[model samples]
Target: MLKLSEYTHNQAQVESHYLYKSLCKWAAKQPHATFIVEAETERKLSYAQALAAVHELRKAFGPAPRRLLLALPSGIANALVWLSALTGGHQLIPFPAGARNEEKARIAHRYTPELLLTEQPEEAEGFGLAQARVMTLAACEALIKQAASLEAMEPLPGQVWLTTSGTTGEPKGVVLNEQQISWTAEQVRLSHQLTPQDHGLTVLPFFHVNAPVVSLCSSLLAGSTVVIARRFSRSHFWSWIKRYQVTWASIVPTIVAMLLETEKPAFLPGKLRFMRTGAAALPIPDLLTFEVRFGIPVIETYGLSEAASQVVANPLPPSKRKPGSAGRPVGISLRICQPRTDETADLCDVRAGETGEICIAGPSLIRAYQHNASATAFQDGWFRTGDLGYVDKDGYLFIKGRLREVIIRGGENIAPREIEEVLLSHPLVREAAAVGRPDPIYGEQVVAYVVVKTRWSTQLAQELHQYAAQRLSQPKVPVDFIALDTLPKNPTGKLERRLLRAREQARFTAQDVASHTA
Candidate 1:
């Protein structure tokens, strides 16, 4: 049996340049150990079986390395296809299964992948790819089964092509190499202290960088088991945990908020260890309420696609944890830098407790964006995260908000998070978002959108306005409160503040036109 300490020590000594080597080592040592589970179908795959499957699936792509675009949903098949690409040294471009054909077509045209792999070949009709370039999973599986003998080839490192969430603007392509992926997986494994005994659950989509690095690759390196769900289901979340004996789960703030609204399980699973939250800012009130109600610790984390996933994560247990903090940098060098007007100038570090742009440089981070998009983000060997945050005296990071998302009201700069946090503190508020609206006098004024538990009315909006005023400064108070059935969010459950800003701008423009007509 591999003890936790022994596994940790072994992981430290192993070379992490090639993830395929590590997978092969695990298959050789623990051939029969379970590796992954399909939560919906309850199908299991062992390490040895997974390796064999990878070898078989690699044959479909031929011996030559090519860029393969995968548009499959989250499941065991998607995991296997990803592993095949990684081990076979083929670059994999993953697109969301639920994305519209037009969106997928735009990505395909931009990247120009050599092959397109999807569950339904019909969906690729308008992708502008030839029929020979399109390959369905079923067809690939059939080819694998028919092949009498697989060709012997050395497993080489591969790359992952991803894009930013594009909440602020157009998404840019990010390419992560094998070493970067392996490095991030090792860092995540070390931070979480995962071992062969642990079982993880992944509800985040496979296409997102979070699932592949934080859940799949990390678990693979640890020789642990992970349950891959089709999607996040509030009704079945607890049931899956109890049935699979899951110890940890990787989720976003949206999932946490939704889970809080649902009825608590009658009895919490004893084997479950913690819930990891990332990809967005989680309201402190919701975090506290979740811990108090469920008796499970929520480990808040911070990461971006360019970093290959996790850059900071809170310590698990038996250590001092500061709520609302993204913990400390793990396997990376992080510094808060003062904003500069010139893009070519050097960036100076900000003093502790002062908010500035969060910058990171590490082995896990990408050097540049694909197609040279957003070149300004990388400078002086550091990737400016474009997020405003500060490191405490104790070295914990507190994220304020996005640097681009700041609201300037009459020359007073305000962080939207401050207003949103105050609004979220209200019992009636379910979700809150703040954006800057165009103002004739102040240039930009603070506006808030909120989802309430009860009905929304003019009186309710007035009450929220007064509630916010008490907790915020005069300038920080929202000039207008708009009740929404729900806040606009991206596919990954991140609030799309840019969409809100656009909506406000459109409304203000319409009103201005009406006034002129009158």
Candidate 2:
């Protein structure tokens, strides 16, 4: 394995080159290299065909619009539009295709994009956008045929706008320019030791940074092929892996757990080097169990939409991979800092090994949120992440929990992850979430919600509580344990703790009213 200093220095070179231009250059040189394979249709596009398709799509655009709103599903068409929008010099905002109508309206009203692209043109009314400004998949396909063949055009600089997962409040729009996007992709390619022989499997939505920057763009930078799936189908996941001969895959922790729950395939397909999991905190037990059960190592990574998907990842093999850590900062600078609050912008003062806010700065990180400068304050180019963690002596990053997710009990600050991790170690607990519930006595008390593999029962809840009691201190143990078939998760499969707290509060209010009447 290369030394950390050597890796950082080598990756520094990739920032100078634009990813879109490099992709085009590589495509023209290696025209015959397989670039994309659509698993649903068993369709494939070689680099030559992909380049031609992108050119056709660009020509279809005619004049580059100021902003393009994309709500296309995962497939070859969506991939083409993404490349075309970036290369043709148009600001792009790709909304998750499965987003709710209200969510779509919120963005459309805010941005008022010049063009809205979707798989279903009839649904354009839902966004309250003019029909004339909307282009359906059919329209894009028709334009592709009418597009005139032309020489390779110079790549243009454009911005890609993305929204935070909105797990807490209204999602904030994050903006990244072409250079930032491409540089981040190159960083991922270099960090993962990607090669032309590699094949990436992407089931993540196009709206997420992981799909575009981590999987597709990184594969392009490495001169590798990517298999695009319409949606994540656990039943067909392993089969597709076998069919496509996939080398590695980009997935979230939820998908990883689901795949593990599914029965094992008779024979695992391809020479799957590793599976990269991120976008949410992965339970340490799940990470270790996956490696033990599937024999494919799970490379845990950490990043945000603002950083263009990956800022750090566990190096590909033969190197030390700390199971619980998010690995070292790759092609970026990281710092542990004193926690910042909403009222003030202060410099970080934490030392190494001291728990604090995880802060980062790099070419890949966006300096500002779109139209929301007040949301973030940068100190010495470092963006305070709001995530809490500390770097170990060996430099691996360990996440404690989100600062907002921290629970306070009788003025004692507690990270929910610490208790959640202990609860998840129970064999019956498939998923667990710990949050603070309003309490008159303690200001706030710990409460837990869990999803069990077996049937829900009072006996089971008691067993889980007793198990947690054995592992956790008196105040750390949950005051209540609620068993559910499944916990509430957002579109990205992250547990919604805020919503859980709200629901629990409402339920308690209702209980109080009933008791007063009785």
RMSD, every candidate, angstroms:
12.5, 12.0
lDDT winner: 1
Residue 343 miss distance in model 1 (angstroms): 1.7
Clashing pairs in 2: none
Q: Give the poorly placed runs of model 2, Cα more than 4 Å off.
A: 1-10, 15-17, 142-150, 165-168, 405-518
| lDDT per residue as tens, model 1, 1-518 | 11112111112333644567767878888988999898988988888777777787787787647888888778767887887887788899987774555456667788788888788878777577774488886776565445443333587777889866322334567898878888888888988989999899999878778888899989999999989998889899999999999999988877887898888899688888899988766778888999999989999988888889888778888777788898888877788888766778688876667888888888878888888755888886789888889877777889987757767554334567756777998999999998888765455788999999998889999999899876665767898988889899999999988899999989999999999999
lDDT of 2: 0.77
What TM-score, over all chains together, does every model reach? 0.76, 0.76
Per-residue CA lDDT of candidate 2, range 10-93, in tens? 256554336556666777789778898888888787777777777887766668756888888887778878888877788888
lDDT of 1: 0.79
Residue 338 lDDT, candidate 1, scale 0-100? 89
